[model samples]
Target: MKILGLIVEYNPFHNGHLYHLEKSIKETNATHTIAIMSGNFLQRGEPALFDKYTRAYAAVKNGVDLVIELPTMFACQSAEIFSHGAIATLNSLNCVDSICFGSEEGDVNILKTISEILVDEPNEFKIYLKKYLDDGMLFPTARSLALFDYINKYNLLDISKEKLLDILNSSNNILGLEYIKSILKLKSNIKPYTITRVQSQYNSETIESNICSATAIRKQLKDFTNIDSISSVVPCNTFNTLKDKINNNFDPMFDDNYFEILSSIIVRDINILNTYFEVNEGIENKIYQSIFTSSSLDDLKESIKSKRYTMTKVKRTLNNILLGITKYDMNNIKNIDSIPYIRILAFNDKGREIIKNIKNNSDVNIINKFSNISFSKDDKIFKTLIDYDIKASNIYNLIYYKNNRNLLKGPMDFYISPKYVK
Candidate 1:
């Protein structure tokens, strides 16, 4: 069984996602396909356009055989850690033979070369990196400039600095490089494949006719004034599901209410802000100053963001704070082996066969039922992990109406069972 593993956050199952799924299967000759997807929260430190279950079901209905949740810790982090956890989870399955991801460059060799450079971190690169950091540039920008400097200094691969910048700056290519770096770090046997991204771009916010980006689709969803053109980009499954959600008044999450609600939560526990993961460089103090003054998430993030900490970092820190994920809790589980468990989200008939095989083959625990395993009273690490997952779910539900909040209890998310979809 040549199982293909995919790292995804199908914030909504759109046309681009469907295209990638089809191309992945054909390109890899995969017998089974599995996705380790983000749950209700995304790497951007915002709630997914829709809930995980709906998104997972849409994935399976489209092409994915099985869907598993990427834990909250990794899901709401930067690209490097997010890719690390995703690669780790895919590797844990043991039965997976290859992983396929979309990339801007779309060349496996080019992606591999970049990953090698990142992993090796030549002395020249480090010196350049340090020089930029010392100049007070943010880590990402500093890293970018350092890459350019190192490429120029060594003339590595005879590739121009400007050309390399184009590849590195592309969002999917950055993730693709990190994915390769993680695989190299693990010395894993899984093969990697990259498919060229098509049509709309990663950050494009306008809906095109046939191949719009998810970000574009989201913009249309956010403004329901004219949605007729959305069908051109999203599949019937996604379109219908979104329509159902909209008709039921569940489409207001992107509105200002989320930050309004979050503000109330932040004010209630301002003193404990520093304890959460990613709250550093006195960012907690800035958040404190903004919590009472800022009216929206944008306003709060604007107040907290600085030259050292990017806007994404500030938002990610807020996500950590909202869910009570302490830095101590994260530090205790930095080792890849410390990722305690994996939660199955949804699966089709083919997925059931894979699950049966996984029981005998997987490295990590395959959680289908919540009650089967519980962290003992003394296991703070595991408890803290599960605690954040539950808390994140509860907060994600805040986007829905009051009565619909808390739809899934702690056990339901962690213990009850993975949803079986035909």
Candidate 2:
């Protein structure tokens, strides 16, 4: 069985995602597919429009065979950390044959060439990178400029500096590069492929066609756009699910909902902020000061973001603070392979078959029921990772209370189970 793996954040699986899934399976000639998706919080440091299980169910219904979650600790971080965790999760499965991703630059060779340079960090590349960082440029920008300079100085490839910078700048291409970098770092055998994104751009906020970006879908939903407006963009199942949710008065949520709690946490203890991941270089002071003037999440982000700190970086830092994800916690899982267990979210018959194959190849615990974690390899670090996911789920579930005052109380993860799709 050739199992194809995909790393995704199917916030609400749309037509573009469906096309990628179908096209990837055909291109790889795979018999089964596994998708490593983000939990409630996404890489951009925002809560998902819907819960993890809802998104995973849509993916399985649309075509994916299995959907396992990328743990919360790794899910809501920078591109490197996010890709490292996802690639490592797929590697741990021990049954996946190839991993495919959608990218603006669909050439795997080009992406791999850049990944090699990043992973190796040649002497000259290091010199250039250090120079840019010393000049006070943000890391991503500095790295991009450094790569451009190093490649041109050495004549590594026939590509122009402009073209190379373009590759590094495109969001999807940047992620694709990280995916290949992680693969090389681990020396994993899973082959990587790229499917060129078509139609809408990655962060486009307007629907150009039936395959608009998820950002556009979320934007419309945030404005309370009729579900019919997004009908043509998402799958039938997704549309129905979203429609039912809207009809029941459960609106799509965003980071704004947690603003008050986040502000309270920031003002409650300024000293504790430095302990969280990415809350360094005096950013905690800026965050603490911003809360006094900021009225919303976006306001606080704008107040803190600067040339050295990009908007995405600021957002991720705020989320880390709110979730109480500390630098110490991240240090323990520096080696991606240490991501203990596979947390299954949704699956089908083919997915079950893949699980059976996985059990034959690796000793990693496969958990579908939250309580099963107690019986699995018990350790402080392992329990800490699971606790973060549970905390995130409980917080995410809080939004539903606004619509249904009678919803279940307490943590949601304990009562939830992996969705089984026939």
Candidate 3:
């Protein structure tokens, strides 16, 4: 009855993801699986190719026993926040025995060791981190260099600074480290496991094999919109589902889909952007300035991104503004350790049993339907979190009708029920 948990976006549930899922189950020797997935938005601050319910249905159809939604407030955030939300949710599910993630390094020991050092932040490590920051390096770059130096100077691990830097810089490894950190911070009993990422790099945009990156699949969909273009890279369920959607004239969303709405909001009241999350260091002015000259989302990002702010960070900040996630909102729940409720998206018979197990073992609120949320009367953060998820979905619905903007599909979360697979 061991339940394995996976933190994922799935996007379209490609072959690489399928490989990871099978290998994770095999490695963990688990009987059941639960996936805490992102909703309409993703960690990269981009809209998903398909809506949450569609993606969750695909995951359940493939292998995952249960799928839970990661709140939008954390879904479209930095590595730390995203990992915290995911790990906390899994930890709350007391029946989960272990969690698995794909990483370039593929060694839980090394990732765990690094997470320990980060959580402790020994005096020497702080000195090195401060030195890099004082030299004007970006926080991520600075932190990586600091870790490289701290580890080497202390002879913590036998790895070289070059190799260490490579590990720290890799996208999957970074997320893996953060996952480990969250587990340690929460003092959770859930064990951690990692598998080596295969076939393609995280940011690769070209498909060369059956196991290419999600980025490549999305790029193909954006350019061709033909299911055949991505058929080889994704599973049958993904291919057939996408084909059905395409056949019905449904469009896959991309980051640029929200560019017009985002740009308009920024131009309409640039000062208002200052109130949003991560809209610091006068970035609002840069975004406002760039809006007049920039044509597309990518162009606007390129205009505003600098040594102080990486492109990914800038994108997240801009999307946060568009979603109206204020710094105040985040500040309000900084100390709250776990997600307020578990929002189930999809499940099967095995998943139903796991839900029963959760009900008997943990006190965490389980949201089977939107109406169930009313039980949390005294929990302000619960309302805030659910509101953001609903807001993000409504906003995504707004941009989804790019072809016929007048025919806006209103409020999906309230009407859409959790997908139950046989």
Candidate 4:
């Protein structure tokens, strides 16, 4: 049976995501699909809008066969590390035949060329990148300039400078390139495919028709009780599942007390503000000033934003501060060469069979219960992140309606369904 791999956040599974999965399976001719999903935090350095387990359940309900947790270290990281971790997990599965993703430029060949350039890192590109960075361009802008210069110098304008610029500007295509790079770096045999996204701009904050961006959907939910405002954009099933949650007091992740905790942390630890991962000099002092002066996270971020420091990077640094993920932790996490274990979150009946097949054939640990297993140092760190996730979930629960809180008791594997096929 052919298996296809997807790396997703599924912050809230929607119609667009469903389309991607169905199209990917059809295009790849895969019999099964697996997704390595982000847990509590996402790649953009923000907490997920929904908890991982709930999102994983929604994916399985929508058609994903198996759902594995993307460790927090990689989940809240730069594109390169995010792609590396996701691809590494799929590679470790040993069953995935192809990895499919969405991109603005659906041409796989062009993506491959860009991936090769990035992976090989030629001297000319390096010199150009250094020059741009020394000129005070942010890393993303610097890299884009370097690539543009490389393409022009080599007379590769046939790739369409406009198209290349569009691809570079797109967050999805940028990540898609990283995915391809990871595949090449690992020499994985999995074929790559891209499906162009239909409708819904990536960062658009205005809800339009039935196809709306997540940003727009999120914004609509803030005022409207029901999803009637954005129902057309999501699958009927997904909309139904979320109807009650959206109508009556829906709290996005980190909506409750995130800034309060962030403020306290910033106030208490003045020295941690100086770490390398903190990035953009004097931001620590700026954060200290904003802790008492600013009213909201956005306001605090705005107070610190400068020409040299982008808002996204500043928010990410603040997140790192909130999580107590220091430069030391960042370095240690980066050095982890291999994924220590695969933590299964949820799976359908067929997914259980896939797990059994993997357990019988592969050498990696398949963790079901946290308590029954002895964890390595890397695994322990992952567990610590999970603990933080549970804390976040508990906090979210308190804000909506106090109920019997279901903290992740042990490893998710124990609670997950694991039946063998006859």
lDDT by residue for model 2 (68-137), tens = 9999999999888999999999998888899999999888888988999999999989899899999999
Clashing pairs in 4: 210-233, 225-247, 368-413, 368-414, 370-411
Residue pairs clashing, model 1: 370-415
Models sorted by lDDT, best on top? 3, 2, 1, 4
Model 4 scores what on Cα lDDT? 0.74
Q: What clash pairs does model 3 have?
A: none
Candidate 4 on 1-422: residue-level lDDT in tens?
Answer: 78899999987788789989999999999998889998777777677765576678778888899998887667777888889889888888777799999988878888887888888999999999999999999897888889888978997546665677778878899899989988888888888999988787778888766666777776776656346776787787567657655454455554333788778777778875777465547778877987788898878888888886777778777776766665766676654545667877778887987888778766767766555445543566555545544443444344333232353344333454422222
Cα shift from native, residue 51, model 3 (Å): 0.2
In model 2, which range of ten residues has the least summed lDDT?
331-340
lDDT of 1: 0.79
Q: By the lDDT metric, which is better: model 2 or model 4?
A: 2
Q: Candidates' TM-scores?
A: 0.90, 0.94, 0.95, 0.87
Expressed as tens digits, the lDDT of each residue in 10-111 for candidate 1 is 877888899999999999999999999998888888788777877888888787999999888788888888888888888877778899999888889878
Candidate number with the higher lDDT (1 or 4): 1
Off by over 4 Å in 4: 127-142, 152-157, 244-250, 254-257, 375-422
Q: Against the correct fold, how does model 2 do in TM-score? A: 0.94
Please, what is the whole-model Cα lDDT of each candidate in the order they appear? 0.79, 0.89, 0.89, 0.74
Question: How large is the C-alpha RMSD of every model relative to the true structure?
Answer: 2.9, 2.0, 2.1, 3.6
